[model samples]
Target: MTNHQETIKQLIEQIGILSRKQEAFKYEIFELKNKLDQLQSSIDASDNVEKATLDQTDYVVKSEPIASGHREWIDSNVHDEATIKQPSFQHHKNQNSKVTHNTPQKSKKLSPFRKSNLEKFIGENLLNKMGILILVIGIGIGAKYSIENELISPLTRIVLGYLSAIGLLGFGIKLKKKYESYSAVLVSGAIVILYFITFFAYSFYELVPQTVAFAMMVLFTVFTIVASLNYNRQIIAHLGLVGAYAVPFLLSNDSGRVEVLFSYIAIINIGILIIAFKKYWKPLYYSAFGLTWLIYLSWFVMDYSNDSHFMLALSFLLLFYLTFYLTFLAYKLVKKEGFAATDIVMLLMNSFIFYGLGYAILNDNAIGEDYLGLFTLGNAVIHFIVAAIIYKKQLSDKKLFYLATALVLAFISIAIPVQLDGNWVTLLWTAQAALLFWLGTSKKISIYEKLSYPLIALAFISLIHDWSYNYDSYYHLEDNLITPLLNTSFLTSILFTTAIGFIVFLQRKGDFISSLKEGSTWLKIVSYAVPILFVFSLYYSFRLEIEAYWNQLFSLSELENKSISDYVVTVNDYSLRDFKIVWVINYTLLFLGVIGYLNYKKIKNIVLENSILVLTIISVVVFLTQGLYALSELRDAYIEPSIYYNRGSFYLIIRYISFAFLGFSILSLYRYIKKDDIHKGFKIAYDIILHITIVWVVSSELIHWLDLAGARDSYKLGLSILWGCLFFPFNRFRYFKE
Candidate 1:
């Protein structure tokens, strides 16, 4: 047996060795086949290329005139393909030969104008320009320190600054010719250093006469602007603007020289505006805007206490406005990029600054704060007029129109609250909302349509603010009461919310159906919100009236001291009043649900239809539950009279109302579930709930009547059995049918 096993093992080992050799042969054969296929494909591709080249040669010769150079180019490509050994290299060589031979004449013509290696070498090297920038700023700071410390004569520092600037300018011009790319940085650095030096020379050290210093500054600005235009680079413009704005801060010595500082800013901005007309540099414009406004705001905040600065503020405001307007013209009219987000932001920023400065001027008693509204209104009017002009000229972009409308509405929103007291503000906002809605829906003016949503939202927010005035009064017991709903404020709030809802509903009619069908999210939101907001307004008005009545009925002297839980304990005492309020709310909800259903029928929106149905069902359920609870309370009150005097009448009313609600809920559930296409499971759930409700209502009434007659326990048991048998079969039948 052992020998036989050894023979078998030997045989197995031999078989394994033979299997390994077989696999090795298979892989080698696969690789060889792949190599053979690649070689075949290469040969085929080469043949196709040659054939294509010959066909092209024939076509070119027959179809059009062929230059000798072009004919030679085709011949050279074919020769390269035949001569090259490696397939890849030969293909690339053929392509290059074809291109070179074809464009030979054009290349010869353009070679002279192409950049040389030396020029590229210099242009790529910016270390020298960066070093010069650092060095110039460092030297300026050092020179300023020397002058302040009296280490060197101011006149000597001034001369050194001039010489350095001149040397740098010359170096820049040389670079401009040699490299061109790095020239802007060098030139800008020189201009900044020179401007700083000139500013200190006149405004700080008094080393030069004011006239001479101003002339030198103007000359530097003119040179900078010219260089910036010549180079067509924004970096030069940016540096020049930064240096110009910085001069005021560097020279500021608590002399309260507001006029001179702003005058300097105004001149610098004017130069920037001119540069803007030539080149559209967003960074340059933004930097000038931010720095100028920041400096002006800083100066106003720090020095506006001095009455002499009023005129300075006025002049600077006008200058800033002009500068912004000019930039606007540059973008809208010159560059014709149309109005963009940046333009809108700049306009808003300008408006804010103008308002801030105007407020400051008024706060200083330079003008009456009451008349501040006049200024705001005037600004709004101007913006509206400008918008009208833009619209008339057909230069209005959506963003531009939106910004313009927003500014006007914002000013109006602010001015109304400030100028008018009491409920007038609310009325104004209501009118504004209506106007915006009208404009948004108008076919004549398309631009305002884009702004309609946001503008209406703003008006709504303003109306909210207007409604807050009556909040304290509506809730207050006595001493805190100020403005009640009987007053104009609350009345206006109600009227305004209702009118807005009406207008929104009217405006949406044209497109609401299409919008709904297209699944427009915003339109759906507005559609739902309008009715809900109107309902909320009515609810709030009712609440105010209820609170007022409650205050008159009870002494709320201890109201403030009680926690919410403590107040809830007393809630049952006013159950009757709450019942009345809830009854009104229930009917209101039902009415709104009906309206929603009608809208859904017209629009054929599933979401709207389902939402209204669900809301109505939930409301009915709640009303039924509350009615039961209220009846229970009334029954208890009749048994133990505290606030009521008619026990018999209270009990009768409770029973009648409870029966009425139970019947109404049952009918509503039946109608809701009877609708076709409802899911079987949901219908079954509704049937089960209705059956349970009917049983409870019947049991409760039986129990109440039985107690009144002093019935025995057997009667209750019999009634229970009867209800179970009837309801169980009915529910089972309903479920199976569903």
Candidate 2:
């Protein structure tokens, strides 16, 4: 009897272990099914390539999960984003539209990795450590002396600096040749010592102008000459060694008053020649000038602008800058064989970035108020010299452009106040709006490339400060809302700019909506939304008044007198209630629509797209409801909460909904784009959303399970994000996987 009982107990234990194994297997199978669903979705997305447009899958840069960076281009105001489908010219013809759609190619191709010698050395991580060590030790001595007596002779200073640099460079060569190239970093210390000496000398002693210019020429010439002497890597290493010393010498002339800044120019041209002749010097020597030009002008502007009061001196300097930049650019423009539409855009953008830099630098009044006057004259003079180059395109355009842009701005900044009799800040946005439309129609440029952010920024600023604040500050529903309505009209007009930009680009390409088979769903949607967001105020004119009144009352004067205040208070209360009802109504309707759509799907596998979309709508509902609740507190009972109207949240309803929707949408669309591959799209989109949700919860701190300071409690709700990930694999087998 005892033996039989023991046998039964052992058998039971074995069965229990097997049962546990079975359950574990089931769990893994569920997870794997979810993964498979996601994989299927990716496959579907690939099948739906409209043209190789955003199919630049490599550019998606998977460095880290995006909380925000450049990728947050899907926001409402992202006018420059690739939101429209530019079809082929053939499609334009097929559409037979009466409009002359002449959209230029979309984006410029980034230059390939053309590594110069400097890049090679950096990439190889050559002799870095040794270079750093030598540099540091040299610095210690200089600092010691600087602290001790604060005095060092020019000749002694030069000698010590050179010795430190040579020592570091020599050690770098030895270590790098025998062991690892990274050893050269030791020379970083020596380079530091080199900079210290040159900096102190330049800062304190105003070396005679002739001597300084002569020294700069000599330094530039010597480094290039030295690099030319040897093709050996060590010799070239020595080339970079002195180039570091010569780097600071470039800045010695920044009084900006150098009417003949030609001395440095002459020296750099000579250095460039030496580099061209000397194979080894080409990279290292070129690097010195490259480093100087990239940073020197921008950095030295403050110093020179502060010192130079002479307008002609500044004018001459700008002349030289524009002259050289154009000469180099002109050579490339002429010589670079075939000119594609893309190449033209690149050339234009490069010129624009440089030209517009003057706008930012104009903020410097240290150069005196007449700097603009000087810039205008000097800029026009250069354009005349280069008119032949731009003549084919009626390129008499440079001066024409500069003068027109500046003068129009003058009308905005100066003439407007006088014209309006100083009572109102005239709406410059209308002019911007008008210009945007005309430019889009006239200029044969692509939307993604041609649309400039500055105009959009101006419109948004007006939306925030001018329209919103004007209503709240002065006019009210109680007083009059015509002022606010007018502002909204202007605001809507300006926001229509992106669409106009799109239309213009489409007209330019002549193939606007031809790629329907491959265009992005989101882009199509935003195309519709931009117009709506632009005219949002028009849709709810009364609501805008409610908003303006509530904001002004809450912020400025709460209930003031009895009768008037009571009426204001009453209007505000009604508005806040509407805000909450709007949230519930919008979200509930959205939820029902999604469910109904999902139920109508012929198969469960196809439901990923709808499911993700519904979740997004729901998330927005939660986010905005909370927002309306917060805003309701701003004013007394009379003021309504402006949930989506005005007020800011880093994790606001729109942002949360947009991201959640986008992530899921992309995943879902990708998985189920193909009928047979439906399950895959849903799975991938679902999994990623889960991943996204988890990340949002943790990073955003949306949940309040843990105490948070400020609005950080937004993350407390983030815990719900796991729904995205969990649902994908758990219900995998049910997805359409044909």
Clash count for each candidate, listed in order shown = 0, 65
Across residues 90-196, which tens digit of lDDT does each residue of candidate 1 receive?
Answer: 12344434334355475655645236545645655556666776888688788869866989787888888888887888888898854566766777777877887
Measured over all alpha carbons after superposition, the RMSD of each candidate to the real structure, in angstroms, is 20.0, 30.3
Model 1's alpha-carbon lDDT is: 0.62
lDDT of 1 at 623: 51
The lDDT values for all models are 0.62, 0.43
lDDT of 2 by residue, 1-738 (tens): 454455556666555445445534444443444344334434655664343442343242232111211122223213332243332222234344433548564445543455454675666555454445554765767656754785865556556666866786567556743343444344434444555555544554443244664464355435434433322234444444455435445445554434444444445544553343332232443344344344436544544444453344345345445544443333333322223454344434434444445534554665444355444444444544454455445332233333334333433433233233211332454355446544544552223122323444444454455545555445344454444345544455344444444543443354444222337784465445444343343323345444554454443322333465465332223444434444343444344344334534632522334554545545544533553344333222223334324433422343344335334433343334444644555556555555545454444333322323334455434446645555576468347543
- As a whole number from 0 to 100, the lDDT of residue 12 in candidate 2 is 64
Worst 10 residues of 1 by lDDT: 59-68
Q: Candidate 1: where is the Cα deviation over 4 Å?
A: 1-121, 124-215, 222-240, 278-284, 301-315, 334-337, 356-373, 393-402, 414-431, 442-450, 455-472, 475-575, 581-605, 642-651, 654-662, 703-738
Listed in order, each prediction's TM-score against the native is 0.66, 0.36
Give the residue spans of candidate 2 off by over 4 A.
1-262, 270-295, 298-313, 337-361, 366-444, 447-461, 476-511, 514-517, 520-525, 531-537, 540-542, 545-738
At residue 557, candidate 1 shows an lDDT of 28
